[model samples]
Target: MKYKAERDCKTYLDTGRLFAPSSKSCHVGLNQVGSLPLEVRSWTCSNCKIKHDRNVNSAIIIGDEGLGLLALGTSTYCP
Candidate 1:
């Protein structure tokens, strides 16, 4: 997106951190990789106690962070 959008897009260290079932409720965090699939079918937040569609939630996170990076002029990718 950084290259194609011609705008600053960042790969947040926390991008992949969203998928850990353990951190399902914790939301954002530092970089960490887990033994999870590339696309989870569904999930529920432990803390919030609410169900969520995996893809939708991920898009929200990625989009929010990407916009943040654009504001900072620090484009990046999901790694």
Candidate 2:
């Protein structure tokens, strides 16, 4: 069974990058890898210079992916 975290990580990897929650143009690639093990829930984007919550960031990505699928006429559901 695939967990949401696995899907979220896959989404990030396939996109080849991550963006700041506050500044969509700001890239934060693999910079937070070390922070995850420490159970870091939030961080400041170097480019955006704004803090972002981990849960919020993941929700945004997942929401966007769902919207993309909806626009493509794909069902956003699992059995």
Q: Write the per-residue lDDT of candidate 2 for residues 1-74, one digit (tens) a residue.
A: 23664565432123223533322222234233333432767767665576767767666665665566667765
Clashing pairs in 1: 9-75, 9-76, 10-76
lDDT of 2 at 14: 33
Candidate 2 residue spans exceeding 4 A from truth: 1-35, 76-79
User: Number of clashes in every candidate structure?
Assistant: 3, 0
Worst 10 residues of 1 by lDDT: 23-32
Which candidate number maximizes TM-score?
2
Q: In order, what lDDT does every prediction score?
A: 0.51, 0.49
- Per-model TM against the reference: 0.47, 0.48
**Which number leads on lDDT?**
1
